[model samples]
Target: MALYNKRINDQLMTNCLALSNELLEKETHSFFPNIMSYWNHILFGDLILLRRLALNHIAGLTPQTLSALPTPKSPQDIYCRKLSDFAHLRSQVDELIIQYCTNLTDENCEQFISYTTTEGESITKVIADLTQHIFNHQAHHRGQLTCVLSQFGVNYGCMDLPIIVSEGSRANA
Candidate 1:
């Protein structure tokens, strides 16, 4: 999971840094107004999930306190962060996520997390499932990002995990 997250983050950072600030801010004809908004949304979601995981008392996954986690003022506030700022924050959150997942045990993954939604709804779900959801969510938005980039004629290259692994192995060899 840590390796998978690292691969995803590496791709995202590479793609984002390749764009100019003006291009990052350009409005995309999609659900998200622009690349920046989509990028920020990904970071915002990760922070929220990490905070929830931290609150679940999962040993190494738990931070000192909930307040220590990054919290957006609101969901919309995420869309307002500058692209560069979001990129920096995303790097930090991605690193923390990799560390948390690396230290997670099977017992910890089997535990359940209980939390209230922003809409005031209560829910309980297995930590392992939630962890997978986090990655799935990132992949969904990354698809959107790639589409948006393509609309602008920006080619991000192969995002497939197998291809990434093969290329990485060749580089190492």
Candidate 2:
């Protein structure tokens, strides 16, 4: 699910890259205020969740990888001011996510992870569920982004996962 989520996000990001700066920065008065905010939020969420996963020193989430992520005070913080810059950073972080996901073991999934939220709350969750939440969170915000894009009459093409699956199947045939 994590790897698939990355693929979907990559496609979504590609669509976002094609958008003009005006549309990317346009205020929609939505929960996130703008398309860029949604993108930044998604990136922030992924970094935080992945950092928590890294705390266990799991495979592919080494100290080097953790050092690569910036420390954000809150999810709403503007880490990437421009979509272009965001895309660059997003690719790096996405690669980190991919590495962590691919190296994850079944034993790792069975362990519980504890972390503090941005709201100053301590929480404990199973690794598998937390991993799902990371992807689900991206999908949630990506859905919002797509809705905003639709409002602008922009076509982002098909978002179906089957497209990715089918492509892989064809390649392997």
Candidate 3:
């Protein structure tokens, strides 16, 4: 159902915020600082991408066919700054979804929202494709962060979507 997927998306978004907050809390005691920075970079980068997509841009296209992000240097500063950005972007995304979700008929789900990426590149993708990409991108980096946290012996409990859904069923869903 469209509502279900949208709810799942919202849940995923919430879990992301929670996971980042939890990760930051755990990072304070992390044994590997660079890994922390790396994890921060992933979340921050995704947060920025989400913001770009929020602007009704092409969702995500690099100026070139391939976009290479710069490396991360500091964890603490980056994490805090991204948290702010993520919070703002997340609010806008939530509002956007709520606003358009009702008018999103069956055909609209398959409709393509075209726009260029900040990289000055062009890409036209279906709503479903881009939505799936957004969640997949987060999962990919969250996996990396899991490894990073595990290396430090910090178990990231309930980081999975099912876990998120179950817990969400009680709290928000």
lDDT values, one for every candidate: 0.75, 0.81, 0.47
TM per model?
0.85, 0.90, 0.48
Q: Give candidate 3's TM-score.
A: 0.48
lDDT by residue for model 3 (38-97), tens: 445544544444443445533233233112332223323364344444444444444443
Kindly indicate the candidate among 1 and 2 with the higher lDDT. Answer: 2
lDDT tens per residue, model 1, 84-161: 665666766777877787778899889998988767789999999888888888888889988998889987777777
Best by lDDT: 2
Segments in model 3 whose C-alpha atoms lie over 4 Å from true places: 1-105, 167-173
TM-score-wise, the better of 1 and 3 is 1
RMSD of 1: 3.4
CA-RMSD of model 3: 9.0
C-alpha positional error of residue 40 in candidate 2 after TM-score superposition, expressed in Å: 0.3
Residue pairs in candidate 1 whose N, alpha carbon or C atoms collide under 3 angstroms: none
- In candidate 3, which residue pairs clash? 58-115
Error of 2 at 10 (Å): 2.5
